[model samples]
Target: MDPRQLARSSVPRSLPEARHLRQDDRFLLVTSIMPKNPAAVAHGPMLIGVTINVLLMGVIVMQAYEYFTSYKRRDDRYLKSLVVFVFCANILNTGFAVADVYLALINHFGDVQYLTVSTWLFVTDPVIVGTVACSVQMFFAWRVQVLTGRWYLGLLTASLALGQLICAMLMAWKCHQYPAWADFVKFTDLIIAWMTTTILVDVTITIILVWYLRRHKTGLEGTDQVVDRLIRLTVQTGMLTSVWALLDLVLFLTQPTDASHLIFQIPMVKMYTNSLMSSLNSRPKPKVFSEVTDNIHSIAKFVNHRTTMQDGTMQFASSLHPEAAAHLERHELGEFQKKTIEAASSGCKGDAKTGWDNAARAI
Candidate 1:
């Protein structure tokens, strides 16, 4: 009783003094409640993800600039429009990511409650990613049909792509419904389906295209060299996205308590857009025509000499002319080679140019 009465009597009576004490107590309460290292799990990954996303955005800008400057007249209108669409979508995705990070870590600094909740910006990521991926996959599917002349294969690829897109949209809607980060596990099935389909579509496209390109080798040194290069590129570009997607899925499943998966998810759409641009930009130029001309001369020589019989009789033997035999027996001369032969025989440089243009697109 005596000690309590003494303490109460010593308390500050001025309003300013009491207000200062209240502020000090408030500061102590905040420090006590705050986690020792909130950034490790929540803000740090987002910051790193956003940083990488921005770097990729810069790369995309450079690639887009190059595409427009170098292929302005060379690319068809549809291709040009696709480039524009992907570029715009990437910009939108990056913008939302930046905003999401800024709002959580900057505007609401030290707000633990705010950091624990998901926002609309967070939901946009899956939607934009699905759109860009589907567009690229559909483009490849159309190419598969054009190159392989197998409509059913293309349809299968397109179907997988569409399934992934639907899953992505559903996942986004579920994420929106569950704005709490802790509740993300509720939609784990959707995430699994989306990432699984993404991986499948990427692998399927890679395998189908690689198989077709390998089969496309004409045995001629020059043409086979081109096909080999295409095969390497298809493997590299296709596996890149698939590998990253797998990593993202693995991290999401293993580190369910953290946002580490965002590291790969943030820059995913950029990878797709860059892969497409790289493919378009890497198309063989007029310089390749010289090699094609050399190939044509070699073929002509082989056809002329090999088709002549040993008895001085000119007899066309299918065995001696593999290209023609492929054209006749197997009908396996791909669109690119068929066009190349027709253009060369017709002596139309314009058609030859068209054939060369179709070569990379056929991949």
Candidate 2:
């Protein structure tokens, strides 16, 4: 064999060996380090936690805007205090969420096991979210009490809210003790209790409020329309919160290891806050029904608190239904006031009192 031909053949053999050596080195490098778990990588807890934090930040902005804009509009001191508390809680939640993302993603990147370990930041979520949730529930409970005149039902709802808060706080304390996200299943009982109470309170409030509004739907077209709107609003807000809580509970119970529940958990507080703010801000304007609905002229039937008989002894009759009195008080103008305001705005030329009386008597 020629020396050059032999050398070329040797070069090919050496090339193969070199390639094998390189492949072995790469294999050693890959295997010596931990092989990444696709499941773990794909469903990174940090991914869910951080994504939720972003969403939470957006919601916090919404909450701030709502508070500032409605501050002048809301005069109820109690409600004002609750709003302040929710705003503060929302801020605290955002802070905790930021810390959660930083700890899980930035501080311990690729250390996926640490993601299963609960930290101080992770536990704080239940506390802050629970506080906001319970406060909102109680506020609606109070409304139920006022509208339905059923103190027992209101107390029941409030008590349920308190129960949920206790369970949530308990869960937080437990998380702080364990500090392991994987071990969350150990506290399944507390989770069930907390989520159950929340769902019950939401549903109870919705049912009672809706029933009361439906019952108070005075046959008059305008009043009935207002009642219908109120019913729809009640269902919408109540269902949204309750449904989220229920989903969270279901996912937590079924997939304790997976962070799937975080999807519902993250935005839960925002739902509660937005629902409360929406209801408060949407206080019906009397003009909505009185001015817009042409059938309001039928209200003349219920006008005039006083009637004169043949004997001329003055008699006062209230046309308001006891069940509807609260609803009407909130949204409807008194007969005299309605007539006077309508007359003034309409530029009707007449003695306002006389015209109101005449209209009332005609009914």
| Winning candidate number (TM-score) | 1
Native-vs-model 2 lDDT?
0.65
For model 2 the TM-score comes to 0.72
Global Cα lDDT for candidate 1: 0.73
Name the runs in model 1 displaced over 4 angstroms. Answer: 1-39, 286-342, 347-363
Q: For residues 1-363, could you state the per-residue lDDT of candidate 1 as single tens digits?
A: 232233334444553453345544645543454444445565677788889999999999998998888767766678789999999999999999999898877888766567777889989999999999999999878767766668999999999999999998998899889988779888888898999999999899999988877765556775556667677878888999999999989999999887789898888998889778777766544445455455545555554454443543334444322233222211123454545444443432343344333432332
Give the alpha carbon lDDT tens digit for every residue of 1-363 in model 2: 332232333333423653344444544443344334422532354457557656766766775675556454534466677777887777777777777667756776646456547677767788888999999999888877766657899899999999999998998999888776666778888889899989998999999988877765557776566667778888999999999899988988777556678777765777788778767656534335334323334443443323333443223344333224323324222243444334432322433344434433221
Task: State the lDDT at 129 in candidate 2.
Answer: 80
Taking all chains together, the TM-score of candidate 1 against the true structure is: 0.77
Worst 10 residues of 2 by lDDT: 325-334
The per-residue C-alpha lDDT of model 2 at residue 189 equals 86
Per-prediction TM-score: 0.77, 0.72
**Candidate maximizing lDDT:** 1
Worst 10 residues of 1 by lDDT: 324-333
